[model samples]
Target: MKNISMKNVVMGSVLAIAAVTSLSANATPVCSGTVAGNGASFSAGTNFVKVAFTPKCSANVFLDGEETSPTVFRVGSASLKGKTKFGGSSVGGSVGNMGACTGAGGVCSGTDSAAAMTAASS
Candidate 1:
């Protein structure tokens, strides 16, 4: 009976480890590339800020953004190929403005242009 209990514990541990490994394998890849013609515009109808940009990457990637705090905006996710565009909205105010922008996927960065309604990745 003791041996059976120990075996059950070992099997449970193995299953847990396998589950973690599977999750890591399916994790989304980061975005890496140069951003060009990146810009943002506010839509009064939807009360959300719309962002558009073209990332020059070797492979396709996913891009996402949200309002982190107040007027701050953060963009993240996998690498990109061809053209990519995403929108972000703020929860604090009626008018949404992208005060800052960022990127993910290894070493990635971005700049926010509130005046010109544009953003660029670096």
Candidate 2:
């Protein structure tokens, strides 16, 4: 009975390790994209690593950091600008990251609008 229990423990440990390894291997945060009826689209990375907006609109996407400069990604018709929340860490995250949009030349407003903007926040 003792030997059997030891074998069971070893098998359980191995299986647990394999499960963890497989999960980690496939663990990737997903990015987000938004498309408007006017043929505009917006996309941003999960960890604030990348941001893309459509129709050649200029945008700045970033994670909140004291010494880091906000990186700009130029998008097209629909522009997307995002800042990770005060305590948040991801770009497209709901709780921590905030996204705002505006139209070219300040015509449109909100994410639903077909505008572009640059966002900077502390």
Candidate 3:
């Protein structure tokens, strides 16, 4: 009886895990297209950058970039100044790490295999 109970518990746990994984996998929506007019704002105190762009897949989307290292910038705002192609699933309105940012006229770029998108500012 104990063996059967343990088997049931293991099976239940596996099924619960699978269900959670499936739900998470399906939560992200696929998005693709060209993005333009990339721009970013940096908050030095928090080490956080916010990037905004016009995406063909949706209206203007803002993505967040958190920097691990301290960032130096003469200006808090930067113009990404170019267009790039993006194809991938969007999580919380961002296509993977598409907007990892740099400051002081630096470029932002990233690629995510799960989202299948690459983004760069020129």
Question: Candidate 2's C-alpha lDDT?
Answer: 0.24
Summarize candidate 1's per-residue lDDT along 14-103 as a digit string, tens digits. 232222211111111222233432223222221122332232222233333333332343333222221213222222211222232343
Best to worst by TM-score, what's the order?
A: 1, 3, 2
Q: What is the lDDT of residue 33 in candidate 1?
A: 33
Which 10 successive residues of model 2 have the least lDDT summed?
22-31
Model 1, 28: alpha-carbon shift in Å? Answer: 15
**Local distance difference test scores for all models:** 0.26, 0.24, 0.23
Instruction: Give me the displacement of residue 94 in model 3, in angstroms.
Output: 34
Q: Tell me the spans in candidate 1 whose CA falls farther than 4 Å from its real position.
A: 1-59, 68-70, 80-122
The residue ranges of model 3 lying beyond 4 angstroms of the native Cα positions read 22-122
Q: RMSD in Å for candidate 1, one decimal?
A: 19.9
Alpha carbon lDDT of residue 11, candidate 1?
A: 29
Question: What digit string (tens of lDDT, one per residue) describes model 3 on residues 15-74?
Answer: 322222211111222121124332232222332223322212211222222223223111
What CA root-mean-square deviation does each model show from the true structure? 19.9, 19.4, 20.6
